[model samples]
Target: MAADMAREVKLWNDKREREMYDNFADLFAIIRTMEKLEKAYVRDVISSKDYEPECTKLIAQFKTLTTSLKDTVPSVERFMETYKMDCPAAVNRLLVSGIPATVEHRASSSDVGTAAAVAECVQHFITSMDSLKLNMLAVDQLYPALSDLLSALNRVPQLPPDFEGKVKGREWISRLRNMGASEELTEQQARQLLFDLDSSYNAFINSLPKSA
Candidate 1:
């Protein structure tokens, strides 16, 4: 009985060890993918429309995985070294930076504040619209998307304090907050929200400086 228990324990340990390595493999892949994405964006091989969402998704996944592996993967840089990974761009993007490259480029412009804010507003607007299109209509999903849009709208120095986008975004966020996190918007609600977003996006575009 003692020998059998030992064998079973060893097998269980082996299984868990394999799982950990699998997660490491996933982490490795995300990093490599991010590096390629960064290069593609720099080379203009991919449009910002195609790059931003994929970059955002990878960053989110990287964050979640790193959080889970905090105990075992104490340092991401160290992990990279162990794996012989040479993705400096991914290291900077996933580890050092918080925002996407599109936003980062705008932020480094001569008119840093306005440029960055405009980029942020555009990004959030696109994110919100894409979320709705993807049927991510649950209260939790919609609330954050709208909230981020509102926040970004507020940051644009050229936009009025009561821009239509800001007003509509706030109203939607309020409605979403009143619902349970898991609750989905009805079809009519989703339609109305999409209409409002489209209208606001057009208005936002018109509000931009002609040179921008």
Candidate 2:
């Protein structure tokens, strides 16, 4: 029975990873779409050299998240064969209560969940960035769902070509073949920063006190 439960847990974990595998990817897409949404925020919130540093960092960071989503998400199907929604409260509780201490600071900012929700939006953006930094932490604690997904892939006899490499050690990803094409992925390039900055602006608007 315990062995069965363990399989259940593994399946549950795999299911969530599978979900995030896509979610993380989808979030990256939203991040890209944010460019369209955050234009004004970038113009206002980030200014001069002050924003430049963050510009460089955000681009790099978003790229990392994008790559993770692209590569790790599909591994879900490659890993386990089921979605485990059997007991979701345990996982949901963690999402509600389990943001890291560092993130708690960001989430609780005098800025978040207010106004045009700029603070909240920035807070969520930052928190999502943190989640990426944390390897998108899983379960109620720090179980490496990503690593587990990798292990599970070993069982698939004919893994997809994309699934066969190690992502941890890669520092450079190039579109060498498409490099000669028209333009960049748009989502992966610097424009995405503009979107996040714009979100900040909207958040700033949303964050404004209502009594005014």
TM-score leader: 1
lDDT of 1 at 125: 72
Against the reference, the lDDT scores of all candidates come to: 0.80, 0.35
Candidate 2 lDDT for residue 54: 38
| lDDT tens digits, residue span 80-195, model 1 | 99989999999898889855787577655677776666656765676677667657678877787678778878878888878899888888888888899999999999999999
Candidate 2, residue 97: Cα displacement in angstroms equals: 38
Q: Each candidate's TM vs. the true structure?
A: 0.58, 0.24
